[model samples]
Target: MENFFDQYRDEVQPALKSKLEEFILFGYDSVTEEELWQYLCKKKWKREREAKLLYQIVNDILSVKIGEYMNFATVEAFKSPDWFGNQGKDELSKLL
Candidate 1:
């Protein structure tokens, strides 16, 4: 059976590649793609402010404090798919 990361790569990674690339650039050639994927799984960056979220990971690697904010548009795009999927749905409707 495929592991979580394996499944994630096959499913989510293709769609998320560009955003993941943006995160990888901060690693300065030292961070491997696998490492970034592991980190994403560990940190849940997709569920929240991913740019700011990415900054936290990058900052740890670089030993610098930066990337304090992300604009609304980026935040909207970065939220977890589960969160976005519920945006137009009503809880009461689901309950009925």
Candidate 2:
């Protein structure tokens, strides 16, 4: 299922790039094209990838909002284990 969208990535690269630029312009400096693509694959189009047409996927990318993408990114960050593991106990305590 992971490679389901790889075939269309090249076809959709332009739309993805445009969407990424829009995110950056809106002050989402940390957002990358890959992350955006991941959000689309893992969230937005997760259940409908096979049924969706190329144009629809492009529309989804172009129409996604900053808030939506940021929310997805924040959740993804929280899911990563590196955040607390990289910090020592004292550093973690300081953060808390």
Candidate 3:
């Protein structure tokens, strides 16, 4: 019944937003978004660099948004905490 964003939005977006905001703002919030982001990422400090970082952050948000409904196929089943159920086992076994 739960959708993709619905599942991960609650889990991923907040953390991503917080990290991105922190990555942009850090301990201080006096500077503008463009200024802070460049200083943090150590980019070219140009208009385009700022714009690119902004774009990447938004794109990361989308990835985190969809990743909520997703599962990590690379992780082994027996090594995973939630692997006791059949949901991850069969899929993982097929990979090995």
Candidate whose lDDT is highest: 2
Give the C-alpha lDDT of model 2: 0.84
Local distance difference test, per candidate?
A: 0.44, 0.84, 0.40
What is the TM-score of each predicted model, taking all chains together?
A: 0.31, 0.81, 0.20
Candidate 1 Cα errors over 4 Å, as ranges: 1-6, 23-27, 45-96
lDDT of 3 by residue, 1-96 (tens): 332233334344454555455534544333333332323233222234223444554455434322221222122234457744687788888899
- Model 1 per-residue lDDT tens digits across residues 2-96: 23344335544443455445545776344345654545554444354333433354443333212421232246447657652554457746766
Candidate 2 residue lDDT tens string, 1-96: 555777889999999999888878888778888888899889887777356688987999899999998898899999987775745766988988
Kindly report which residue stretches of model 2 are placed more than 4 angstroms away from their true locations once superposed: 85-96
Candidate 1 weakest ten by summed lDDT: 64-73
Cα lDDT over the full model 1? 0.44
* Model 1 Cα shift for residue 17 (angstroms): 3.6
lDDT of 3 at 3: 24
